[model samples]
Target chain A: MSEAFSGPVAGHVPVLRLGDVLMVTLQGDLHDSTAQQLQQDLAETITHSGATGVIIDISGVEIVDSFLGRVLAEIAAQASLLAARTVVVGMRPAVAITLVELGLTLPGLRTALSTEVAMDLLTQGAPRVGVRRESP
Target chain B: MPEHTAEETHGSPTHEVRDFLRRRREQIAQRWADEPLFRSVFTVSRDEAVEAGKAVVDALAEVADAGRVDDPDAAGFSGVREQLARMGVARGRAGLTAAQVSSELATLRQPVENLLLSDIGEAPAEHVRACATTLTVLMGTLRVVVMQTALSEGEALIDRQRLQLLEVATPVIKLWDGIVAVPLIGTLDSARSQVVMETLLQSIVEQQARFAILDITGVPTVDTLVAQHLMKTVAAARLMGAECIVSGIRPAIAQTIVHLGLDLGTVITRAGLADALKYALHQLGADIVGPTANGTGHR
Candidate 1:
């Protein structure tokens, strides 16, 4: 799982393509420019590769300011436009808390516990009701 | 001659008051032992009251010697301020208000004044008046210190109990695998809602639960602030990769939410904790079917 993303590094953040799905793992030191470039590269890859899903693993990120939160939300928005479902996986509890505190709930963004669950949600043609999304 | 030179160095009535207190410590303490402040606090024994009285007298003398007779927060009064505050609290517990305790402290100056005036023939009359005035000023400062510390002590105690209440009220329970619930009881204030959100998020990570349920059936009301807080908590859970379900929105609360024009868009809601747990189990692919004929079934 640690070496899941081996092929095709895009900018500082590695964007790996596995089968029909694209994997992008974000690190803790993801700067403003690095995230922007990853967004651009991810959008291009999704279109070119015709990937059905984009799974972004953000477990390593400890601090997420409003800028990163907005960028993540935008990335998901872009992925959906490219006809690929984006599932943000492995968001740390602290990062979630900071994003919420900053009033950035990233509305309409899908989240999964891990890359395995993300793959399950994307690959399995189960009823979308199982993956419930609610805003309180 | 050395003592005279030392007294002259101060060049004020503070030194005279300090010496007078030290010289007449025993008599002053003996008199103050009967005052309400000392008498109420040292109820077990008269000797104990006298001993406590002597300590206060010594602190006052030190303050006067340091030329800070008018400053209640002088380093010399540090040891006795907390003790006096506690004594004031005891007086409060005994049904005497702070004003009464201060008046009791005011009565303390008379005995010291008598001791000072008794030797007025030896010292000049003007000098005796100066020492008496200094004593009044010192006692006034003591009153302010007593009021300040006692009020703060009461506030700190209330703050602590409130924190403990919050901890006891919010309990995050693990309902099943990949599911956690916080059964919140009582009204949801802004401060309390903050605690609920933090506790739920932490429990989700620790249990690695994919589903989080917030059961607010025990909550009495749903005002705008509380509804807003609930909204924030739900959003936070989603960001952390856990699906949060808010359950137990009673009929009245549901109506109130709509009337207040509050929007809980995209967040899941259920009728009660049972329903919330059922939804979570279903999402986890668990069926709640009855047994066929063995008279056995999993709930």
Candidate 2:
């Protein structure tokens, strides 16, 4: 899928279609501007494609500062509102360190090792709920 | 030999007086050369001694040729003796006193003294003082340069450390199928919060998932700053239209959150991974409709 916004600062944003799933790979630094562009692009892609699930591949990024992380979280929240599932893929070691050091945690976020694994999980059958407990 | 009047007094007595005068002049010259103070001040080596001797002899010859010594009592050696004494006093004040220099020469003997006179000569006080000052200045300059170099190296090291942190922070993979699972390990500060936020938001848009599971079992504790950042993330997620489910709340973290009075009112929180997974399944409309024993179900 093409980027929602294009400019000198925009890096490569690749869109791939696997069966009914649509995967977008984000490469390089995802600052505020970049995140906005990605959000715009994803919104457009989702509107037209009718893909069941979407995956974001971020293996190439070395740093994910607070602003960029917020953008990603917002994207997931927005996409869920539109009835599409979102998955994040491929976090490097440095990014992991910064996240922990900064004490910043995502409340309800899913992660996969690779884009293929994420796609498999997304297309899998419904999740099994074993039991239900009444609220105390 | 018979003295008549003063005008006739000459002859044999004159010859004896002349010899006495010559002896007195020689004695004065020898005394000046032997004086320790004078020798130390001048630091005269063999060449200087030879030259001084030749000059004295030449002056004496000129005086004799001029016939200035008509009588022994009138001989002019007193003036030369006074000049030598003055030279000794001046040299002594400059730390070139005759006694000290003579002792040094005695230890080194004639050969070394001759080398010093021919090559180095006597060092003046002004020259010595100037050399010392120059050395001090150079040493100070060198010290400053060394300190500056060390400071620059330290700055570079800090920069490298920050870069290394960034290298480990970027997230590359996410799965947002039925549930969103974010496994967080390590302390969370403001800078890292941004990274986590970006990764999760992007993952949500890409995966189109309904429920997000944030597992923080790896975290040891939660500080105020970190807690605030988490709250911000939850808020941002809501704005994006995704539901955030926090899992893996350690007991200590729960206590801290309560103690700090952090309001996590809107976000759903679970105590462990199993509970979070159950909630995730339910939120995705995968609730078990018909249950067989042992958690088996058809949605």
Best by TM-score: 1
lDDT (tens digit, per residue) of candidate 2 on A1-136: 3455546657446567776677887777565666787788787787788776788887778778877777777878877777777877776545654664565455555665556556666787343222222321
**Error in Å for residue A28 of model 1:** 2.5
Model 1 chain A poorest 10 in a row by lDDT: A127-136
lDDT per residue, candidate 1, A1-136, as tens digits?
1344432352468789998899988876666777898899999999899998899999888888888888888998999898888889888877877787788888878887778778888887452334323311
TM per candidate comes to 0.88, 0.37
Q: List DockQ for all candidates.
A: 0.36, 0.04
Off by over 4 Å in 1: A1-11, A47-49, A125-136, B1-11, B296-299
DockQ of 1: 0.36
Q: Write the per-residue lDDT of candidate 2 for residues B1-299, one digit (tens) a residue.
A: 32243224322222322332243444433443454533554475644443443334333333343344332222333334333334433544466644553343233223312332332233343333332333233223222332333344546668999767754754534442535677777888767777777777677656754456677787778877876777666655543445677889988889999998988787789999778877776754455367668875664
Give per-residue lDDT, candidate 1, residue B299: 41
Alpha carbon deviation, residue B245, candidate 2 (Å): 1.8
Best by lDDT: 1
Q: Write the per-residue lDDT of candidate 1 for residues B202-262, one digit (tens) a residue.
A: 8888887889999999999999888888888998888877889999999999999899989
The C-alpha RMSD in Å for every predicted model, in order, reads 5.6, 24.8
